[model samples]
Target: MKQDANEFSSFAETIASLGSLTKLESAMSAAIKSSRVPAKETRKMLKCMSIQEAGNTALFQFMRDLFEKVGVGQLVLIRNDIFRYDFAIDNSPVCKLYPHVKGKKTCYITAESLSQFFTKDLGLPGTAEEIACQNAGDNRCEFAVSLQPLAVYQLALDQLDKTIIGSVIDGAGPDKISESLEMSRDEIIFRMNILKRYKILDDDYQITEIGETYHKYGEGMGGDEEEFQPPWKDMAVISNAISASTSFAEAFTEAASQEPLWDVEEKDIVNLAEQAKKSKSFAELLSKQVKSDMEE
Candidate 1:
């Protein structure tokens, strides 16, 4: 009886020790389900990576936009990998909530939020870990995400985006890559900038050791990528609705002229109706700035 009692006592103590962590896990899950942070936002971030060619600064801005939309503030990208990402938040709110709590990682909610956001919302098979926390005397709260290889490839790369790598494999220069891929010289430059940002290609536009491995294994592996529904379906629905109504397109085109293309104002949603019209011609409008999200 004493032995059984001791075992039960140990189990109870274990649960108690993990009580806050479990509660945090539950809160993160509930927030994710309720917020339903659109997958399109994530897709937009990846798309921005390809098109903006503005490097980490642009990436950080997109993340800021995304996390702010979902009520997670001040997210900054630290280290980005093809199948992994590292992020940090400054002066974390959850940590601030626990002034007396110190000496250990206390930002379980933010860490779990990132994990659930990637796994549940983005459909990326991954988990995020809190590597550093201000409560633990770190300057910022850092979270690292490790995603499965093929799943990330499916989500991150467009079919044509791989052409640059293919060109590199064949000893093709930027000009050759551009000609083979039917992309403009400017577009090729943008793509090269993105490749360099990944360290996949070096200064001479040659594929690095990592790029060679990425080519050997990561390429042509996501056969089931099409099974996943794109987040742009909602926009497609609106497009279909407009296409269904014959008058909508003409009316939209007239208003779209007044609408800004890539530089749409964020604070003003008053002209969202006009923006929807622009979304119909999203490719043409973003043509100068971006090509497309993912061209199948």
Candidate 2:
């Protein structure tokens, strides 16, 4: 819709005013407010899946489904692997906002959202970089999310998982480890298989160097697992942004609408709110109404 475009355009203008690096950083950070909700919900479909099972497959599928659900655009997966995942968005909404700006990567929101989906949603830690951009003369917006093995394993492993690894590191067999942990041998074997899938254990179940490193530091260097807090708690925004009806644009609009919080008033925020409500200005809203009636 034009309203969303204008609000995003305002945000773009403000961020574009800063130094190149700061502008990119702010643009990426701004995506969290709009992106976190759908990413959180879409992840539930794969809740029972572990990083070992979901890493390259379910994780990517989750992202593909999420971008569509959030009305961002279709995510075309190019490659899937343990270290890197490459994807492209042919219709990147963020890129289309900058019709006149050129010669630079402009899909920072799409890129960062992918990073958040991996780390914050799928428990896979990584940073995503926009490698090719339509704005920079590329045919499509392309991104590569690179994962660090240690950080991925750290977040992927649970307390019992660490215990299993530590037991393996001490040369204990599954039967002995299972007895020690007061768990069924099948469960112990299952977890060990998960560790093996992570390349922390060899074919014979002996611990690898990755396993040794993980045993020492995977759980807070062998202490605790940290969790990501939602935007309301972290950003000091309204608590009810969790409502199912709240879309990404709505969230961004609300955040922008809080103009008084800033050092200076942002007239763009007011314009966005007014533009969003009027049928003549917000084609997206009109389409939503039609879809809602059809669904009803």
Off by over 4 Å in 2: 1-71, 76-83, 98-105, 115-126, 132-140, 178-186, 217-296
Top-lDDT candidate index: 2
Mark the regions of model 1 whose C-alpha exceeds 4 Å error after superposition. Answer: 1-27, 34-74, 78-84, 148-150, 208-213, 224-296
Candidate 2 lDDT by residue in tens digits, 36-96:
4333332332222344344345435545655654445688877655467678889677665
Q: Relative to the true structure, how large is the alpha-carbon lDDT of every model?
A: 0.57, 0.58
State residue 211's C-alpha deviation in candidate 2, in Å. Answer: 1.9
Give a tens-digit lDDT track for model 1, residues 124-225.
778888999998899989999898865765566655657788878889987888887788989998877767766678898889897888788777665543
**CA error at residue 161 for candidate 1, angstroms:** 2.2
Clashing pairs in 2: 217-221, 219-222, 219-223
Model 2 residue 125 CA deviation in Å: 6.2
- TM-score of model number 2: 0.50
TM-score each candidate.
0.53, 0.50
What lDDT does candidate 2 reach at residue 296? 75
What 10-residue stretch in candidate 1 is worst by lDDT? Answer: 4-13
Question: What lDDT, from 0 to 1, does candidate 1 have?
Answer: 0.57
